[model samples]
Every structure is written in C-alpha cells, then in structure tokens.
Target: MKKVPFIAVEGPIGVGKSSLAREIANYYQYRLLNEIVEENPFLGNFYKDIDGWSFQTEMFFLCNRYKQLEDIEKYHLNKNEPVVADYHIFKNQIFAERTLQSKQYEKYKQIYYILTANMPEPNLIIYLKAGLNTLLERISLRGRDIEKNIDPAYLLQLTKDYEQFMGKFINDHPNVPVLTFECDHIDFIKNKADLEAIFSKIDDQLFINN
Candidate 1:
C-alpha cells in the first residue's frame, strides 16, 4: 500500500519554515498544520526574560503541539490524508534544552517522550537554514511583536542547536528523508524560480525517488 505523505518543515527562528510549509501544502493540496506561536500568553514575557519564563513557555508549547499531533493522527494520518506541518514536535526539545536548566529539562524530557511515543512521525523533513544576519533581517521584516525582544545571541545558539540535532536526527531516522535548503541565497517568497525549485525537489524526494 502507498503511504500518505507527512512532511514537516523545521528550522531555527525566522528561517521560513512556516512560509515554505504553507507553499508546499498549497501546491500539493495537503492539510496545513501550523504550530501555534503568538497565541501563547507567556511568549512576550518569554522573549523578555527567557530564564524566568522558560518552563512555562516550553510547557505550553509542548502541550499544545502534543494535542495538535493527536488530532493529526486521528483525523488526517489515520484517514490517509497527506499533511504538511510548519514545525515538528521534536523542535520542542531543541528549544527546551537550550532554555531550561538541567532538572527542568530532565522532567520535561519525561513528559515529552511519553506524550510523543504514539505520535506519527513525518515521512519527510524539509530543513531550512540561514545565516544569523539573514535570520535577524527576516525576523525584523516580519515584525511580529512577540519576537521584538528576541536576543541575537539566543537565536545564534538556537541555529547551532538545530544543526546538531538535525545531524543526529538523520542518523537516528535513516528511513525518513531530509531535504535541506540554505535560505541565505534563495528568496522563495519573492522569487518564483526559487519556489519552483523547492517544489521540484520536494516532488523528486516524495514521488520520483520514493
């Protein structure tokens, strides 16, 4: 039997994960699953003082993402409907490990594993990445008020964390294909050629090669 495609776009902040995911969903007519970000009440405070609000912020995201995946599993994946998500649930661990202290992270890890044990993993992961300056510029252009107070240092470190995590992810999930794009050179939003290039690669990965 042919498997339904579940594609997740992942990256550090302002790396164009959501935008690319939306484009992919539109092109393929798949269900779009976007991660809730600005809706979190703790987000603003979390940016202002990451240390003070890390636990609350991370917990809220983890719970919400878990619920989102539950719905996807029941209503979409089980029904054999394809889906394209802006963020992968594993990203929670990336942010949590970066922000939370050792004890808090240990506890968070326990909850994370239990909640995600039965979750459906993406068949393909589209990893977007950019230089720190490019990331900062894109973030500023979007001008989300919640992200106004984000520290450059924090964003820089998050990029590194993503790189390391993705390396291990590829090793751990060899069956799941990952297609990475460096966004510093391509502007998918503004250039039709760039967008088409991405779409072509996605097709090759999910359809032709598969």
Candidate 2:
C-alpha cells in the first residue's frame, strides 16, 4: 500500500475551507477531521463580548484541539492512514494571540507550545483565499445563527491575521508544502471542475511539482 499523506485546509470563515476539505477527503478516501467550532461553550458569548469571553473561549478551544490532535496522532498518524483536516492544530495560536490580552496571550502561548510540542504536522496545507466582500456574501449564504452578527471589523482583522500567520508559518516550516488558491472566483462547493483544479494543484504541489 502507498503511504497516505496528511493534508490540512485553512482559510478565514466562510471561505469554504471545511467544504473543500470534505471534498478532498471524500475524493481521496482520506480520513476527514473537522474542527470543533460550535462545540465550544464560550463561543456564542465570545462573539457577543469578545473582550470579556475571549479567554474562556480560547482556553476551551485549546484543550479541545489538543485532545483532537492527540487522538489523530494515536489513531491515524501512527497507522499511516491518509488524513485531511479542516483546520490545522497550529491555528489555535493565531486566534489565541489575536483574541487574548498580552498577559493572557503569553500564558496561552506557553500552553500551546507544550501541547504542540510532539504533534504531527501536515504533509500538505491548502490555503483558500477570498476577498472580504466575497467572504461576507458566503457567510450570509451559509446562514449560521451564531455567525450572523459577527463583527465586520473583527472578521476583517481576523482574515488579515490568518494571512500573516500563514506567511510566518511558511517561513518557519519550509519543508512543508503550502498551496494557496485565490478562491474568490471559483466555487469549489458546487463546481466539480473547480474542485478538480484544486485537487490537481494539491497533487502538483505535494507530488508532481515537488
């Protein structure tokens, strides 16, 4: 049997990161890993009062993500099974840093480092990029009640932070291949050709073009 690769998809909210991750996992018969987003007890309140509930929300996410990664490591990585995850574990730091206060962020960083110390990293990363307006439209189309009132300013800044985080990630992990796509013009969710194109890119970046 061929060695299965671990793939991860990342993007700002409503960029169809999860949707595309699902497509890839299905197409390739890889294990699909979805983030535990709405499960965080403090998430709803964090959206209402970011400053007040940020710590609780971040901590909850940290613990959950850590546990998820541990499970993935033991169950999939150890077996060499292919895996595709909607969100990489490292993204925990990006949100925590952006949400938590300085002192809180410092403490969060310490915890993040410890949890991530022995975690497995993805063999390939797919970053879906879309314009702010495009993301807003998609967000409305999805119609999630908790996300309806997301602050535009906060979302905008979060998008920027994601881009910056990817930049630094690329610099830090040069061996890991990252394939970025400008998905504003393509609808991978409904367009088979578009999805195939992304798959081709993944192949090209991580295999063919490597």
RMSD of each: 0.9, 1.8
> Candidate 1: which stretches are off by over 4 Å?
208-210
lDDT of each: 0.95, 0.86
Estimate the overall C-alpha local distance difference test score of candidate 1. 0.95
The residue-level lDDT of candidate 2 at 47 comes to: 88
lDDT of 1 by residue, 1-210 (tens): 677999999999999999999999999999999999999999999999999999999999999999999999999999989999999999999999999999999999999999999799999999999999999999999999999999999999999999999999999999899999999999999999999999998998888434
Using Cα atoms with residue i matched to residue i, what is each candidate's TM-score against the true structure? Answer: 0.98, 0.95
Once model 1 is optimally superposed onto the true structure by TM-score, how far is the C-alpha of residue 171 displaced, in angstroms? 0.9
